[model samples]
Structure formats: C-alpha cells, structure tokens
Target chain A: MSIVKRVEANDSWYMPAIFKGLGITFKNMVLNLVGKREMITLNYPEEKYEYSPRFKGSHILTVKKDGSIRCTACMLCATYCPAECITIKAAESEDPTVEKFPISYEIDTLRCVYCGFCEEACPVDAVRMGPEWQMPGINGANFVYDIKQLARRPQLKGGIVSVVDEEERHKAGI
Target chain B: MVSLKQSLKSFLQKLDNKSRSIYFLTQGCCSIEVDNLCSSNYDLQRLGYTIDIDDPREATVLIVSGWINPAFAEKIKEVYSQISGDKAVIAVGACSISKSPYVDENGLKLTDVLPVDIYVPGCPPRPEAIIEAIRLLEKTKENRETSKIIYGAIRELG
Candidate 1:
C-alpha cells in the first residue's frame, strides 16, 4: 500500500508557493509595524516577567503574628528534601505553646533543587516558595540563605504571615 | 610602571568595544536556558554576547553549568587556561555551584577549579537570570577596580 502522494506537474510549480510564503512574512511585518502584533521579545532590564503564584522559585520562611518564625523545627522538611539542602538546628522554645523552634535555619540555594517538597512537608505552613526568582550573587557564601535572609529579608516587608491559625494548631496539638 | 597602567587601560578599552564571546560548558538541564539566551526571545546578541562553540581562546566569558566530577574539573581548568585576557567565569544553576541533589563525596564544584565572578542560583535558572549575571560583569568591567587581578595576570603572561 503506497501512502506517498505523487507530485503532479502543477504541484512542481515554485512561484506560487514562494509568493505565499512571502505574503505571510509581509503581512506579519506590516502588522508588527502598524502595532497590531505584540512583540515576543521582552526587554528584560526595563521590564520583568511575572510568574504565577504556584511558580516555585525561591524558598521563604513564614512568620507568626507575634513576629516570630512559624517553624516548629520538626525537621520534616529536612527529611523530605531530596537535595538535603536544608539545615536546621532545633532548640527548646521559651513559649509554652511551642515545644521546639529552629535556632538557626539555613538553606543552600546552590544545593536546593527547588522541588517545593519543603513547602509540602511543612505541617505548620512554615516554608513556602516565594514569587521572587532573582537569586544571582557574586560569591559562593551569599548563596547559603540563613534564617535572617530567608524569613527576615527586607523584600518580605517585616514578614509574610502564614494562613495556618496558631490557636487552631495549638488546640489540635500539631 | 606607568606603561603597565597604560597597557591595562588600553586592554580594558578594547574589551569594552569588542563583543564578548561566551563558552558554555554545560552538563545538565541548564543548557536549555543557555539555548534560550541565544533565541530571538532572549536575544543575548543584543547585549553583545556571542556564543563561541569552536575555541575557548576566543571566549571572554566562561559559563560552567551543572555538576563536575574529578575528570571534568581538570578539563574545566584546561579550558580556563586557554581563555585569553581579562576573562570572567559564571557559575550557572544549582548543580555547578554546589552539586545539589547529586552531591557526592567525590563531586567537584566549579569554584574548586575557577574563580567564579557571578553565581546564578536556580535548579535551572531562567535566561533572564543569566543576562543579569552578564550585566553585573559589565558593571564591574566599567569600574576597572575589579579587573586589577586580570591586569596582574596579563603582566605575568607577558
């Protein structure tokens, strides 16, 4: 069974096909010049691309209403993280409500895969993927994001409050 | 001594005029973003950066993307040595910078072999991030303060 189509003498003509291709190009050029067509090129320095809310880029540590870190230092995120980029030092909390808290929480951005597993593993809504993707730095030391850099960076503007209710969690005993 | 400063100034001026050629030693998915940089959408050429595929000697900037083993580390050093006059090195993606999930006892980082000027951290950084790294390099070059080490290297070469 021959599925190949035979080329007729009429089909061999090149001029009409060339003209059709050129016409499309001409139309596009005209449309672009007339400002009818949107340019695909994004002037990066002058403009920026906005990723969706779900877009995972950088990691952020959520804070409680009392201006303290929301993380209870359960080490769930560290255990679940495939990259093992997250390092947390668990310490006893002064507050009666919270049993433990991370004395020092650090994430090596260079080692992180950004799988958002940390965010998913977090029971207290402590860790999340932030909207800001720009993480370029000059030195290797700068890539290792500490608690201050992660939770208390000026970009977060005091801190991003978690949706998880602290009182509800306390009642539920999470 | 005055001639040394004069020569260095001339070299910097030459660098400013010439379009920087980049040699990308890619080993992971970050290559996709590097390809995007050359595409019309990103248009790396607009910023006077051309991808050099043939020779490292022609490259002004060396971009190392992904993890490096012991053998790859030696190769990177060789490539770095080949790159001539006031060269800059950029470490792109998580793997190259720190080996990420693939971290092994024997794994070698880009920083171990080369002095990385820009570290663009991402799983696979967007092309925009890479562009920003180049922009930072450009700013540093304009200042002439950071290239003092390169000037010393050039003097040693002579």
Candidate 2:
C-alpha cells in the first residue's frame, strides 16, 4: 500500500547532491567572509533581545497606592484560570476600608499558561500580567510565587497598571 | 600532596570539557514542546548536551518532563532503575514537581519516586530558561565538590 519513488542512477550515487549542498555552504562562507551577508545569530545573554509588548510573561498581584495588597480574595482569578494554578485563601482584613484580603495567595508558575485571563477576570484590577518574562527557577518553591513575592513586584513599564487612580477615586467616594 | 585549589580546578575543568548525554522521559502535553530546544534556533547541542539518547544507560542526565499519572509511576521507576551509574534527574514543568489539573491526590509525586537534582518550572518552561537551569545545575555540582575539598584540606591541616 506504500508508494515508493523511483531512484535514478545519479540520485543513487549521492555524490552530486552532496556537492550541491557543499557548494551552497561554500558560497555562504565566502559571502560571510567578505561581509557581503550579515550574520543572523545573536550573542544572547550578553545581548538581551526585546519581546513584543503584548507578550504575556508572568503574573503580578497589583497593590493600592497606600502600599496595601489590592486583591479582595474574590477567587475570580482562581475560577477563571483554565490550568487551576492560582490558589487564594481569603481572610477579613484589619483595615476598615477593605472588606477582605488574601491571607495566602499562590500562583504555581509552572502550571500558569500566561493567558492573561486572570488579569481579565479580576474585578478590582488586583492581578495583572507583568513584563518579567524570565521566570525560570532551579526548584519547585521558586516557581510557586507566594503573596509576598507577587505584591512586591516592580510595576511593569506599560503592559498593565494596578488601577491605582481608580482606587484613589473609589476611596474619595467619587 | 594535592592542594585543595588544584583538585578543585581539575574537577571543574573535567566537568567543563566533557559533553553530556541527556535522555528525555516525557509524561505530559506541554513538556513535548521541549523538543524545540534541539531546533536550529535554540541549538542546545552548542552547550555540549546531546538530547534524547538512544540508550538510557548511556545518559548522564535524565529529564522527566510533563505530568505523571498514577499509571506512569511504574514506568518512571523502571526507566530510573535502568539508567546505570551516577546520574542526575531534572524534573521539568509544574506537573512533574507539583500536582497540576491533570493529576489528583492519588497520582504519584515526582520527588517521592526519584531523587530530583534540578527543577525547571513553567507551564512549559522557555527553552532559554531550561538552558539556564542546566548551567546552574553544573555550577551547583562544581560548588559542592569545591566545598568538600576545602573541608578535607582544612581537616588535613588540623
């Protein structure tokens, strides 16, 4: 039932095909030597490359202007997460202004799909995907970012904001 | 008598020069994407690691990537046992290190089954990050040896 292509005498020899490949290689080598062609290979690690603006890298828990964790512990992110990587344990906050705050919030970086759905699901604008794409770790614990790590992340350049202005307006009862 | 520094230097040099063979044991979906590391773009061969070794016995490092279902536990144990001599295990992806949506409580945890030396975490970790983890593992190995030699030298002096 298998179809087989006929091999010609020249094709069976294989020498001509090899020479053709070699010819292309030599041409490129000569071109490269004379600076006729530019090198495509980048010296990475030493020279960092830029990713697209829309690139969803890692998850960050946004904060209020008063330096308080903004998450209401609604579990919207956990519910929306297709991977079910986000876990939030809600507790009544000591602050009279806020109703609930996450006592323990963890996102297993290994399980996260980086879909930005969590950011979309957050009603309070508490979760946002940051620009910190390099999230590699040597151990399991490193990948599982706790509430402390998530809250302290430096605000990314332009991807998503923590709704700081909106929070301020809410506090002013506007 | 060989000095501690001399022994440390020799050990580091030996580790640096030798090429290592890596055998991948895939258990889940996203981990399959790790094959991209061998593509021309990533070029993991340049790092002196030969991936997907034909013989498990020939491999110096064992990479377990993806989910570990309860049914796959016996297979993991078999492959781990088959690899002869001193070998390091790297658990890649979240499912391997922790329980993902794919596995329940009954599913076997990777750390319980085998002594994992390194972990590369991500839904499917980027190839660059995976490469970085390998380098870090090598560095950690060198550090451990260096410390042991230093302690031995100190004891000899005493």
In Å, residue A107's CA in model 2 sits off its true spot by: 2.7
lDDT of each: 0.82, 0.71
Candidate 1 lDDT over residue span A1-174, tens digit each:
879989998799989999999999999999999998789887888888878899997888999899899998999999988878889999998878788999999998878878898899888899999988856777644777899999989989999998897898778866
Best by lDDT: 1
Stretches of candidate 1 exceeding 4 Å from the true structure: A1-27, B1-15, B142-158
Instruction: Tell me the native contact fraction for each prediction.
Output: 0.68, 0.34
User: Given the true complex, what DockQ would model 2 score?
Assistant: 0.43
* Model 2 regions more than 4 Å off: A1-17, A32-43, A91-96, A139-143, A154-161, A164-174, B1-12, B15-19, B102-107, B143-158
lDDT of 2 by residue, B52-114 (tens): 578787776788877677778778888888786556788777778776643356455688789
lDDT of 1 by residue, B1-158 (tens): 87976777678556454327889888778988988888878887777677746899888789998778889889999999999877789999877887555556657777778888888988888888899888777766643544655555655645
